[model samples]
Target: MRHRPATYLEAEEVRAILARPNPATVEGGRDYALLLFLYNTGARVSEAADLCWSDLQLTAPRLVCLHGKGRKDRLLPLWRDTVAALHRLRMNAQPDRQPHVFLNRRGEALSRDGIAYILRRHVQGATQALPTLDRKRITPHVLRHSCAVALLQSGTDITVIRDYLGHASIATTGRYLSTNLQTKRDALETFWQHAGIRPVRAKAWKPTPNLLAFLDSL
Candidate 1:
């Protein structure tokens, strides 16, 4: 498809994207806060768009419920800032609203493309600060991938990541951690060492000076 996301953004790039939207006004605040909600919750674009008022549980231990693929529901914890952003977004957009979390300028529920367009608008702004963004196709899915991979890099268990993404199989979620070849190599090397593989020294095979002289004479 024309909108396929090729890669993920680093944490810093995410910050740049968050800083793009001017939250001085309600509309700007909604856009800015929506990005935070996506990054912090690691929710899919559809999940974020499909969110209802009741899905939010913003309390001491903040959480949001996302209804994902296969009509399954997954609950994820939200950071304090994420909760704050959602509060702002809800206050501004849902003043008299009910079901959906995000709405268009016309007060209709946001569609997948609408969310993608919003992300793209901010991504272009982020490019100036994070030049690496220039090479990437940053979609809402990429943000989700970034969240999963960032957790992996920070040493979170793969199974936890699978559950976080509501993935049916760990193999499906493992694609995020597999992006780092070095991590895999390190793990394999550790396994080999623990398996009692002996390390060989190439220096031990070097010919002696006398042997080299005899070979030269021969």
Candidate 2:
């Protein structure tokens, strides 16, 4: 079966969702960091859940190494805001030998379900400000899709997105091309300008005399 187009948030909607998390409180701090990390790296919930401090290079040129499916590992650069949120979260984190970066209230590694719950809670709050959020079902994976579409809209190369998302084939990442209408509109505008096609309606067609005679004969 063919895959459905990805469901993703617009950049403004993503901002509204990110704004829902309060970073002043402990749980809020972790939630903020987790959400930012998800958007920044486009990491699968499993990858984020399995993330370890050792996998992070949070200093200058911050990066995270994601261990993806099939034992494939990829490094992704961390945005400054993401790094700052994570740094604050780390400072407030309790001392533990547990290797996971994101933990539950019990100080255990966060599960995929836990991540989904966090996203749902914040998205619910975000919907108050941005009603569009309520129309679409937002999941942790949807955040991943949002990240991919956001990157595509910014004119990032598709091959790079495929690598960034850790897809085995570029075909998987190409789906974003069809999902992003802004990119399509921009492409159409560019084509019209380059091809010298005016944005005017075509005149209605009328049958020629020879064509009418041929039809009457028939």
Which candidate has the top score in lDDT? 2
Model 2, 69-171: lDDT tens digits are 8887766667667789989988966545777889999889999999999999999999999899998988888877766655555555555666677764223
Give lDDT for model 1. Answer: 0.66
**lDDT tens per residue, model 1, 81-165:** 7678778777765545557878888888889999999999999988988889998888898877666545544445555555666
lDDT of 2: 0.70
Q: After aligning candidate 2 to the native by TM-score, how far in Å is the CA of 151 from where it should be?
A: 1.1
> What C-alpha lDDT, on a 0 to 100 scale, does residue 59 get in candidate 1?
82
Q: List residue ranges in candidate 2 displaced over 4 A.
A: 1-3, 94-96, 168-218
Give candidate 2's error at residue 46 in angstroms: 0.3
lDDT of 1 at 26: 74
